[model samples]
Target: MTDDLLLTGARVLDPGGGRSGRYDVAVRGGRIAAVGADLPHRDARHVVDLRGKLLTPGLVDLHTHVYAGATYWGIHPDPVAWYSGVTTWVDAGSAGAYSIEAFRRAIRDFRVRVPVLLNISAVGLTGRTGESRDLENCDVDLAVATVADNRDLVAGIKVRVDRETVGRHGTEPLRRGVEVAAACGLPVMVHIGTTPPRLADVLALLRPGDIVTHCASAIAAAADGGGPVSPALREAHAAGVLLDIGHGSGGFAFDVLEAQLAAGLTPYSVSSDLHARCLYGPAFDLPTTMAKLLAVGLTLDEVVAAATVRPARALRLPDGIGTLTPGAPADLAVFTVEDGPFELVDAHRQRRYAPRRLVNDATYVAGRLLPPRLPEPPRPWIPLTAAQRQALQRRAGTVRALLTAPLVGPEGLAEQFPRQQAAVPLDPAAAVREPVADPVSEEG
Candidate 1:
């Protein structure tokens, strides 16, 4: 008897259909066999009722750094996957040629499905900023050799040319990185924040199928308070270059993003640069980031597509890791349509506070259901531990001070309504300082 499970009475939210309704889905041999209102359960194994929950396809986080031990920026992937319901994640340039094997044998081999983008820098992002300046580390031959050696695990190449980071090497390093990746016939994923030469110049190097992450990020001269995305960006997009939202710590700029969105530029894929420094706040998890987009005018279907099928297509994963269609892996996520007052931020220091945030209920991967735990009850008012007492005293003092003080201007309040603050006079000088400026265009 084949062991199987049935999930029924749930409102399925399918990206392909963009609709929600009661449905039944069946899982057998770690794959979804059927989905509808009534699925046969004769000679079955187990059945679970899913009432009042929204069922969606399992999420795929495309731009993550899961180097584990190779780099400080790398993080263990399983916790983010199982806990957060991400079944497929693409490691956005964590390890280089020298250290990729260890990553494959120790990490990728153990996990289910985690493809990697080999960093163009031969040594990868080790130590700190200038570590990339070491010429030997960025050996093109070594990177090509490594990618050729591990064709099964490596997806493409990654390069960073941030202004404060890559320094003088600039376009030369990027050109070399592309050369190695081109030899291997894989797309290149470039991290654009502080790179030299210029954003337009770097963007000009990317060809169709190649990826440009942090398209709305506040890069070297691409800061929100700067200027507009160079004509090169528009041309690249027109030429089929995929733009990814690598919403990491210093990647997404709210101001630049607003401008880009208003300019009619939309991202092809939405991904979180999920890592230690980024996973906590604005980029809590892929789902949260998707919810933020939903708040920012992306339809539910558009948001889901960017995070799932669109990314799966970009990665060229023919097995179909994005949809919930029959014969696909039984990966799914269940959430509640929560009404919440939430706050979101971008690479720029701007904040978007919304009245709602998606709250996860349960997640399923390969027929295994992992439900989120209920929040723990507050501790009884007992003698506090040293750490707890210190926290409580600080909170108490802050609250008492707030209570005693008179309500001043809107600036004094933590979360004041927009109407409370007086608008500042528009300044022509500020316009000149728009963070994101005209990026370098190989043309000029």
Candidate 2:
């Protein structure tokens, strides 16, 4: 242990301390051997002076995808995690019983620290539209068997119970999902949105330690046409169920988040839900996602807790990750807080307020900074003719239609149609867009 690495002059933020201090940390054999001032540097093999940087426990993104080509919907976890200051990332149901082994062979066995959440469905989100709905693929015995086989790597059970996937048998799938998870003595992570048997009924079935993701989603309108996070959410939280914010392409809702936050019901943890579909904007990576929550009243410590300790606990890897305790794995992140007018987006293709920029300066796993990855290539800024630009502007009036276009769905579209003009004031506002009679009605 004499030939160790020394990282000095860092503003270390220890969650356990609930305070930060300037200190040095020593790493030997992939474990943090010490943290103090004047650590012996004579026998050190490497010394990195991280001055003017904030050092914290490596980010732990509890919700992500890593199956690569297997799950066409997601990017490789190692590239996404390491490049964005996340050392540990849980693959949230990109594979299941049938494909879990292959996933391990291709992903988990690698040097990267990526864990998996076995999907309740065997194939695990196979085809985008309705593959998760096939009851045959969601065999309970099979899922349990898979978990038992890979208990060391399988954190919990994941099931998407949205309207498009679960249809009328929403509760049934969730019940079976719980049963399967119970067989392995593991918790179930249920994705709640848009289906039958309301949010309350579904949440009522969850127990302590079980996870409810997408809790703050604008799906499954209430009797009053509101989002989930209903009275049942309060009941479930009181009972110790964890509310995980899986802010995916279609799950994050500003109104729901604000309502819940105002009601003193913040998410227990925040997850990237990093998939190919939504990675373009709003949900680029985990740090950006965390910054979004940090914008809306959460302290830096509180936001860090959501990405670290809370998520680690939810994954049942509390000891292995989410902290910088002595002898713990040397997973760490360095970040810089930049000022002013930072933009954050939600899953609803909506923008929100952010005052500080949470930029990932660097990331390390077991004391080794993974190779830097290049930033994504900027989109081609097509120089449209004046006529074309005018046409695009005209098309902007039909926002609903433009939103349906494949390219316009992501944040990139906003660049094409900048909000330059303010609408004129109206007496009551309802008279601004008066409804015109149909051609047939007018003729009559």
Candidate 3:
């Protein structure tokens, strides 16, 4: 009969619905009850003052690898999701038919939403590359059956079409991936990388509504590196192929993206492609990747749509996953939209400045606020710079000290017992402690 939660006095932004204003959002039973100035109840079980904050639909990252512990690229989303405001993480090509069951089991414990793009190769992205090199693993029938059985989980198909992944096999893996998607009546997402099969051949196999991740990849678009956009890319953009900025460690380039924008080709979705390696620096999280788009001249509305509704449209996600419309999933993100000449970096290490930025303050999934989660240390195979290694060590040390030290001194404690000798200890020796230099916090 009453709302479960009421968030009042904030700038509500629903790019998918093209609605933006200072409005109150109500949540009930883990779904958005209403989004307007007035509600049925004057109060709720819990009310939060969201004054001066920007509230929007929880971000939907279209490309990520959250199949942790089993694959090389996988990284759990919760560690970053809570702080980054991403509720939906699309695990693109992280698992395939052979590993789909295992992948399902692995993700069962994740706190955030994980929609999958079944890899064409049965082995999936278990290693760095070459998942599709063995054509036997690229079985279309198996992939189709896998999708059919798990229709709700499998968003579409994903194939990494590159020289290293396909080896001498060329475009066969991509063709097979397309076949599986076609049979299942789903769009296929193709990852473009190093040459040998040529970007043109890869693009030729794709149909409209299909996604081309890493569209501005430096390696994949190397031929048009500093120059204008290529004819093949131009034609694909004209033909309705959706472009996604899969900003992985080596997949994004400021120059390339800039060129694309100049040529009137804006990315349909902005994704971090967050994996184990890039999670620390380049593609830190979806918000950071979205910031890169902001730096590259996209307005806040456009960037929000790219990170939310547009990606949802690309995947055809259900349950109003990307909007704050009434009756939609009560997934929300609140941000402190800060004034900035903020410096943001791309995968190529190039920098740009933006006039304003959205820094997350809180993330909510299903109307429940997400608690903080510490990220696991990088895998032994993950390469880190000297500075990064030292930073990790310092962070660990700080956390250790913070948790290991006594929470309160005797002076701050109260007597818990009323028995004789329940008096607090005030001995000068026990109360007096050696002076230690305060450790200057290194975190910003």
Candidate 4:
């Protein structure tokens, strides 16, 4: 039997390992076997020619909401992963101690890897906001126990400190979440926006390894919504806090990103805060989000690192997560670099253009190519323009027509069962014989 799958002739880019250039990758037994020049494909079961394509580690989204069916923000990752090249979907704060078992049950069916930053609020994001309003829901001891119970799934703790989510409670929720993190020895991922607790106050609570998910959010940029970045944000960047682009429906803006970039405060990771609301526009997918960084003048290598290696290291996801190195899981993405003065938009509809973008050609998880899946329509609560709604309806219609239509014309199909072998004799009365049924011999 053939033992390997060889992929050749791609501009291999492994930003995590600092390896880039013309390279061929080999996969054997669902793990990367080798990566170098002239890999022999003679004995490989499958060999794909990937000339003029860009190959990199399967993307790891540091922030996303994938606890589908149970959470207000949840959207299944598999539907997007097959087409978007995101292999690791980090479900950020979609579930908490109260709903973790259900979250686990939901994720059990996912094809991609899903690690969670359990929410500080026991209710999780079952609603759009107010999860942290009730202080009783923010029980620290219970959270620590929940993490203990689900140690393998829980990577860190998440707290949403905002006007709507925390109400008058302010950063008290953030403090409790920090306590939980301190006990668990896990980093806290704080969602910063809509200050009652100022952005400065929020940044102050975060330690070196903790993360600020929507660091480029216009909602928290400054009081006036545009200008120089606050000194607090600069201090946090200097103090080693990781800035992640959680480009959700309302979580990002070009002005803020540009300001941060100009201030030498590059995002440590790039993640599509993909959910029911943002899945369609603004934050379509991780690659699109990466392209926005490119539009902002970041090199492909830097953007790739932010999407892959940097996030993987920040989260300490398993060793092989964001690389194509030998012995790592053979999870990878292949893309065609398309020339495009592509119109890009941030969470607020701020516009920019990218000269080139990565269009996904294939996504593989553990050496097996993932099958296509269409995403569901937006949830009822999600606000969309009439044009956007029309587009979705049109898309649904097209998909329905495509699926309902015959897969091929007569010329495109071949018959597997021929008439000659299955035909009954015309002169059955004259020469009919019964065939024996076997049950080791004849049925008794």
Measured by lDDT, the strongest candidate is: 4
Candidate 3: where are CA atoms >4 Å away?
38-41, 223-228, 405-444
Model 4, 129-195: lDDT tens digits are: 9999899999999999999999999999999988899999979999999999999999999998887
Each candidate's lDDT (Cα)? 0.73, 0.76, 0.89, 0.90
Candidate 4 local accuracy as lDDT?
A: 0.90
Go through the candidates in order and give the clash count of each: 18, 0, 0, 0
Clashing pairs for predicted structure model 3, backbone only: none
lDDT of 3 by residue, 1-444 (tens): 788999988898899867899888999999998888855446588888999999999999999999888899999899898998899999999998989999888878888899999999999988999998889999989899999999989999999988889999989999999999999989999998887798888888889999999988988887434333788888888999999999989999999899899999889999999999899888888888887888888999889989889999998999999999888999999999998888988877899987788889999999999998888889899999998899899989998998899999999999887568656768798667886666675342
TM-score of model number 2: 0.81
My TM-score estimates for the predictions, one after another, are: 0.78, 0.81, 0.91, 0.93
Predictions ranked by lDDT, top down? 4, 3, 2, 1
The candidate 2 region of ten consecutive residues with least summed lDDT is: 374-383
Give Cα distance to truth, residue 268, candidate 1, Å: 1.2
Stretches of candidate 1 exceeding 4 Å from the true structure: 1-3, 16-21, 108-112, 220-226, 370-444
Mind giving the per-residue lDDT tens digits that candidate 2 earns over 1-444? 584688888888767435478888888888788888778888689998888888888888888876766665656666565668888878888887888878888874444677788888887865664546668877888887888889788988888777777765667777888898777778888887665657777887788999988777776434314444466778989898988788877777777788889988889999888876656655779888887887787787788888877788787785558777778788888878777667777877677777775677778889888774433322233223476457546645576465566864476555566678778787776777778779998888
Screening candidate 4 with a backbone cut-off below 3 angstroms (N, C-alpha, C), the clashing residue pairs are: none
User: How do the candidates rank by TM-score, highest first?
Assistant: 4, 3, 2, 1
lDDT of 1: 0.73
